[model samples]
Target: MSAGAPPVVTEIARPWWDALARGEVAVQSCSSCAGWVFYPRPFCPSCGGRDLAWRTVDPAATLYTWTVAEAPVSPHFAHLHRPVLAVAELGIGVRVPTTLVHADPDDVRIGMALTPVFDAGTYPGFTLLRYRPA
Candidate 1:
């Protein structure tokens, strides 16, 4: 869960954080195996390839699953009474853990189309991704 802010950026995940700051989402791809990688790493998990490339992907996904939290999962989220936590599957088959926004929690459905909402100022110097019904 790295971010643009200090103490959140890691050497292997800097590109991802930087891309999010620019309102984009970037994923790593293996040059040797042509496999997609998420959660940023130094080597390809598919084929142990050291040659990894960062590619910006379409900020669109489908709801893979979700839940409405009865209480804040963390103190940082205390302001939100009930948070719609969700895992959205991107077109490339990567599932991202994000918050479902701008919709009613009861209305969320599996396989529902979603789009990214980048919250640049929620955390100082960090950009976060959320999903909303598309």
Candidate 2:
């Protein structure tokens, strides 16, 4: 993949991507069940409700797990050396697969506080939501 390779933005996920472009983060939530959702979909996972809404969420999160990529997983990531890939549990209990920016792999710890960092340039057509030590 090239650096310009973009995510396949479906109609359901457009709002979330748009929010990321505006320096905000949001998740899908069921209007009926009040259940939070990620990787946007048309129906609620908890109640199978169709009344879902996009809601802005706090950028705060905690590192759940991470790994250092000394070798690129794909050609798109070949430009980066030793990038840290991480999963962070958001305040509302969603686990996000994100890159850890401005951090040393050696210093990262499970349960470390994190804050969001949106990158609109590196990926060309899409904005990437990443995290860094808070």
- Stretches of candidate 2 above 4 Å error? 1-4
The TM-score leader among the candidates is 2
* Residue-level lDDT tens digits of model 1 in 1-134: 32222337888988987898999999999999999998799998889999999999987999999999898776666677688999999999998899888979878899999989988767777777888999
Worst 10 residues of 1 by lDDT: 1-10
- Give the per-residue lDDT digits (tens) of candidate 2, residues 33-109: 89998879999989899999899999799999999998899987788889999999999999999999999999999
Clash-forming residue pairs, model 1: none
TM-score (C-alpha) between model 2 and the true structure: 0.93
Full-model lDDT, candidate 1: 0.86
Q: What is the lDDT of residue 59 in candidate 1?
A: 79
